[model samples]
Target: MNEYFIDTNIFMYAAGKPHEFKEPCVSLLSRIQSGELKAAIDTEVFLEILYRYHHINLPDKGADLAWSMMDLGLNVLPVTKKDIEISLYFYQQYQDRGVLPRDIIHAATMVQNGLETIVSVDKHFDIIEEVKRIAPSDLI
Candidate 1:
């Protein structure tokens, strides 16, 4: 079984307003909850969710969402200083590839945790040669 890194956007799309990606992302999450898909997420994912929701005056909802994700039973990896350092290295190399800084950090977390695949809707992951990005639709 291939282990994938669960990107923050998966949770966002699943929880946010309805969009083209909502159903597929919700399905992807269901698979993870059912243990049909093996995945993990780093601490940074929680931070993003918390920050995004808090900015919209939903801090409690953000905390609840974080707790919900934690209850999914998937492995939660840490984002160490070393991961940030590695992200910097990736930034220098992929800066011209249109990769976002947050993505670089995600990639670094994946690398540090021995993961190579990510479940996300972000097309930017396609530019990171070190990691593979799988769309939620494709999985469901």
Candidate 2:
């Protein structure tokens, strides 16, 4: 019953090209869908997924994907004002490490939710001591 924070890249790899990591991503998502593994994604992650789909001229597809995740009962965490404020703190703390604002937001969301594990392809999460970033393959 371990809940993990899911990052946008995991979904992107699952929905995008047939890369080496695609199968693992698909498997991990399938596990989540089946309630084998619990997961939560924040608004920022959802927005990023939607924006990517729209950027690729697949807005409808993106919307469908987002809805499907919701339909599957995935916990969607809101990016609240408090979360944003905490993100600023993370931004300053990790500025020397070259962390992006979005990553800081993700980190803040996880911290706020007491989540210490994340499923992501982004290596930047590696430097965040608060969360353990695992690749999809690790779950599979």
| Candidate with the greatest TM-score versus the true structure | 1
Query: Which candidate number has the best lDDT?
Result: 1
Candidate 1 achieves a global lDDT of 0.92
Candidate 2 lDDT trough over 10 residues, lowest sum: 65-74
lDDT (Cα, tens digit) per residue for candidate 1, span 1-140 = 88899999999899889999999989998999999999999988999999999999999989988999987778999899999999999999999989988889999999988998999999999999989998999898
> What lDDT would candidate 2 get against the real structure?
0.88
For model 2, residues 65-133, the per-residue Cα lDDT tens digits are 888777656899999898999999888889899778998999999999899999988888998887899
Per-model TM-score, in order, reads: 0.95, 0.93
lDDT of each: 0.92, 0.88
Q: Identify the runs in model 2 with alpha carbons over 4 angstroms from their true place.
A: none
Shift of residue 3 alpha carbon in model 1, Å:
0.8
Question: For every model in order, what is the number of clashing pairs?
Answer: 0, 0
Model 2 residue 122 lDDT score: 86
